[model samples]
Target: YFQSHPAIQPATVVVEDRAHPSTSELSPTWNRTDEWYNYRSNPRERVHVLAALDESSYTGGTMNGDHPIAWCQDYQGGRAFYTGLGHTKESYADPAFRGHLLGGIRYATGHTQADCRPENGYRPLFDGTAESLADWKQAGPGSFTRSDDGTLTSSGGMGMLWYPGQDLGSYSLKLDWKMASASGDDNSGVFVGFPPSDDPWSAVDNGYEIQIDATDVPEKTTGSVYGFRSADLKKRDRALNPPGEWNTYEIR
Candidate 1:
């Protein structure tokens, strides 16, 4: 079906092998160990993929580890796609699943990209700047310190520093952020498509938050389209690096 559709051509596919010990090895108990049994050796591995999706529901789950569940880094000015949905034969055979898969392929292949910018727009209030850090006074005592590497670090508050002189709606915004640890709650994100507003809270309720929490229960973890969608990736047992170790995240 994908080959015949030129709109979906030029695609890339990834498959995870359960037979591999890293993912296939079984533990005696489900609760104590970080493995699920029923779907352990399913030829297709459907259960494993579904479990990852289900975990994407809250905040923290199997994703708090150092390893990334799954990722796609090839950007060619088209759509980027991923799916932890290749675990079972039945899953592959399902029409609904196929439809979504095909749609993603088409979109990623540049068959469809939405255009939704306002003709006359509001200017952004906080262009990421050293000065914008001053407005964060009321968001609950936070401090910004210049790192040896020149990246500004903030503690105990929530705010955004827009890049100075960045024109809205023309260029895409990208940045890397990670939690200080793997088990505690950390709140931060790159706010995009923000409308000029007096406070950051306005952006929280209005714009899109590319969430950066490393300890969110499940559905709210790193890479999640906060409150709206989840990244389709696998669950891996890897811990985030120690505090002060930088983890790079890019959003465009």
Candidate 2:
């Protein structure tokens, strides 16, 4: 139930995000035999989808033609990856299948990097580079310092970095980030739906936030849509990389 977008039906998935390390080792349209489970929604444009079901290859598929079967995302300060494969016990014994699993683990653990940028008409909101932040406007007190490696580490007070170039309507925004704190107790979040304002409190009153403090309750912790909703803790835990590791988040 925690899976944001589950599988459509037990069938094979066609690799779409071919550049990702996990799917890069496989053929573009490899097929597998597994029990696919349907998800509540299609996570397309919301994640870097590695594989999708070739609807033509399956009969009961229902995500139009752009069905994602496996994907990776940056959750609140941690990596989040999901794949709807390996239902049957025999899947574990298959060498090709095992390799796929290993590649995913490598990408998730930050042992390797992948081009997880979300496509589907989404543009960079914050790409961890100074050029990307040319129009970024900070509000509140503390600050995030940009490093030579294109990472923004928190250094100052409590504030927010927002895009000031244009007004965002309905679009998927993706970013890669990492919390340097070892205990994962950092205070960070992504706010949406609020207009540009000098006072950060305006955001607090008008916008919704996806919090990054990983040590709180399900409703108030990392991956939570603030106090209104809680991420599925079990699924979140499985997908999260620890502090000091890079993670990605795609907010739609």
Candidate 3:
């Protein structure tokens, strides 16, 4: 389903799946030289694209307008991952490239957990823009402060910042977050499938919470469906980055 171009080319690889372990630590736009491959058909419809070539950055690309360089999927009940990187000897020597390859192997080997199903129709709920922030309202004691960079940080909270927009159903929610404290003890959570109520406890009592504290017990720790179920700790730990680094959460 693919053929390589004749010459080595330099291009920027735009990361499409920040939540995937393979591309989590990578730059949003990674510049490198490699033998770009042209697939007969776009694999995005069949796989979860991890990263792709910025065709505009290089000449002689053959994928027309879209070029996927890395992707992963479940093929006949087995995990399959592919990347068009590492085309040169120097690529293996590169630390970032090595980590990328290792992470892919880990996922394929079932050492880590990632949602590799084909993702589609996801729209931003909070895209680090003030205009986008208009859809949310803060309730309770502490309020969230929006920084110039479009990140909202909770200053104090016995309360929650919630979406006051239309009720959602059968949806997926994704967001990027990081701990501000160096201690790695700070805790927060995203409550889902909750009913509309001014009291923050309404969410706690009515919906499921995807916990965000790394140091808590399994049932209340990171990746846990708080008070309901604990994530597979081994996979959770393997997939999670250390505190202070940005982490993406995809809750469906």
Candidate 4:
């Protein structure tokens, strides 16, 4: 079910699933050259699309306006990943492209974890704006500082920042994070399924924390359902980027 433009051309690659390891390190929009491919039927109904070609940036596109170039899915008992990238010899030598290929390989080989469920219509809880923090309340000592780049950095934190909006039931939360410390010795977490409370400990007692301390024990380290079950360490390690590099989390 493959169709393509006759000649290799430059196209803008738009990242759709930044939470996927294969696309986590990519910018929202990037330019690359490839023999753009189209399918007889859009696979968005089946696989989770990681990236797509921006048809407006190029001349020939057979799939109308939507053309997915990279995707992943769960197979019989394993996994499958596909990408229209790496069509040129230079693609293999590009660090970013190599990392993308490695991530896909890791996912397909069961060395990393990714939520390959088809995603659609996600509303933003925090859209990285100073105005978005209006409904959020800080509990305890430390607070987060909003930067000019639309990022919130934690400082002097023995506390927690939470949203006290409508209760979320059956939801998916996605966020990008990076440790400021070169040593990767930062401690933090995203608490979920908690009730409204002024005390940060309320979350610890009533809900779960997706822990984010890489130096801690398995049960308390990154990807762990804090103090309850440990994540697959091998998979987590493979999925985790080093400190100072961004990582995306998809918590459902």
Alpha carbon lDDT of each predicted model: 0.40, 0.72, 0.83, 0.83
lDDT of 4: 0.83
Could you tell me every candidate's TM-score relative to the true structure? 0.40, 0.56, 0.72, 0.69
Residue 142, model 4, lDDT: 91
Best by TM-score: 3
User: Pairing residues by index, what is the TM-score of model 1?
Assistant: 0.40
- Candidate 2 lDDT over 1-252, as tens digits, reads 233333434455676544455765465467777766556677876787878877677576566677777898877777777887887888899887887788788888877666665677655555445777776888988776876544566667667777778887887776555566899997778899997897788888999998888998889888899989999898777656677655556688
Query: Which residue ranges in model 2 land beyond 4 Å of their true spot?
Result: 1-105, 108-118
Full candidate order by lDDT, most accurate first: 4, 3, 2, 1
Per TM-score, what order, best first? 3, 4, 2, 1
- The collision pairs in model 2 are 6-39, 10-36, 74-248, 74-249, 75-248, 142-156, 142-157
lDDT of 1 by residue, 1-252 (tens): 011111111112211211111222111111111221122122222112211222332233332322122222234443344444444455567554465456446434544322211112223233234465454433324556654332456676565554334446665443334355555366777777766654767678887887667666445666677887765434211323323333434355
RMSD of 3: 4.3
Q: Residue 146 error for model 4, in Å?
A: 8.0
Error of 4 at 161 (Å): 4.2
Model 1's number of clashes is 25
lDDT of 3 by residue, 126-228 (tens): 7656888888887778988887655678977688989978888887787777776776677899998888878899888998999988888999998999988
